[model samples]
Target: MVDFFTPDQIAMLSASTVRCDFLVKFEFASSTMRAWNGNTELVVAGDTYLPMFGFGQIDGLGMSGGTVSENVTLSLSGLPGQALDLLSVALDDTPEVDQQMLTIFLQLFTDEWQPAGTPIPIFRGFMQPPSVSRSAMQGTEGATQSISLTAENIFYSRSRPAYGRNTDRDQQARSPGDKFFGFVASLISKTITYPDY
Candidate 1:
């Protein structure tokens, strides 16, 4: 029962001339990844504020005609060394527990400068491990690096609900059990016997 969009915001978004700005925030818990510090400002390599190039729509794909998977990809340009290092940690296969993952929140604003009202929380999830890449050209243009990170929401891990009967248990039998594996086993045992037509 959470309200993601308000009436006024929805109306403004439907307008063709509405202007929106992007704000990115990174949340991490590690001494090496102390650059962001829960700040709303988008800072890279400790000194630069790189702007986002664009973002992919939050796509949902139906799995098995029941469960739906959702994810979004965000692209950033001119990422600094610090940001790259942070991404590297996430991409590592055997990183420390504290540096294993990081949560990234993206917000959209209707105004470009101050006096801007509270932005809308368009996306909030953990950044998928990504491999960083850089490109350089010999022309007059300098070198630039772009980073893209995809995040999966809660629905990405959800599956279709199981249909079955529940077993009654007393307080003495209410012990902890493997809910996930147990549920899967139960579903597999309930084989439907269709009429022999």
Candidate 2:
């Protein structure tokens, strides 16, 4: 295996007191949204990462034998709007999860909370329909809402993700100008020649 972490990032990780954050990105219906575990806003790669105190933490993020586990579970509990809009979409499209993708990025930070380097994409997977739990306001505690879900890893047990199509339309959906699949439509109808040896 090759070392992919930068020296600065390595140094940050090896520091006596280290600060780090996990940046989470959710892509659905061709839209991208970002959030981070830190308590403050951050700008990385020209994209703003808002604090996701609601994203309390993630479980089962480690890798073994160079392969990710089949599934990881995470929960997000927050009152801030928009960061949790993915929840609404999940509820509305309960049966259409193949079109959505969830990615986790690792970003190392200095003692001052400044980013050490660009966030590195560490995990890619699909988030299952989450179970939402809401609490009614009573006494001093404010109303609370939280979502919990299992994320199936894209690289599980040496298998590819099941959400894929080889059609031209699928290619166009991801990249309109990409014509690699332009000939796929014709190949199926074209005759093939075989040499006799």
User: Top TM-score: which candidate number?
Assistant: 2
Q: Which ten residues in a row have the lowest lDDT in candidate 2?
A: 156-165
* TM-score against truth, every candidate: 0.45, 0.66
lDDT values, one for every candidate: 0.44, 0.71
Q: In model 1, what lDDT does residue 150 have?
A: 66
Model 1: per-residue Cα lDDT at residue 189? 24
Scored by Cα lDDT, where does model 2 land?
0.71
Model 2 error, position 79 (Å): 2.4
Per-residue CA lDDT of model 2 for 1-197, tens digit only, reads 33577787778777788777788887765567777776677898888887775456688887543333477777777647555465676567665444367889988876676777889887888877778888799899898887776778876445444425555666787788788876764563255666636
Cα error of candidate 2 at position 14, Å: 1.7
Query: Ten consecutive residues with minimal summed lDDT in candidate 1?
Result: 163-172
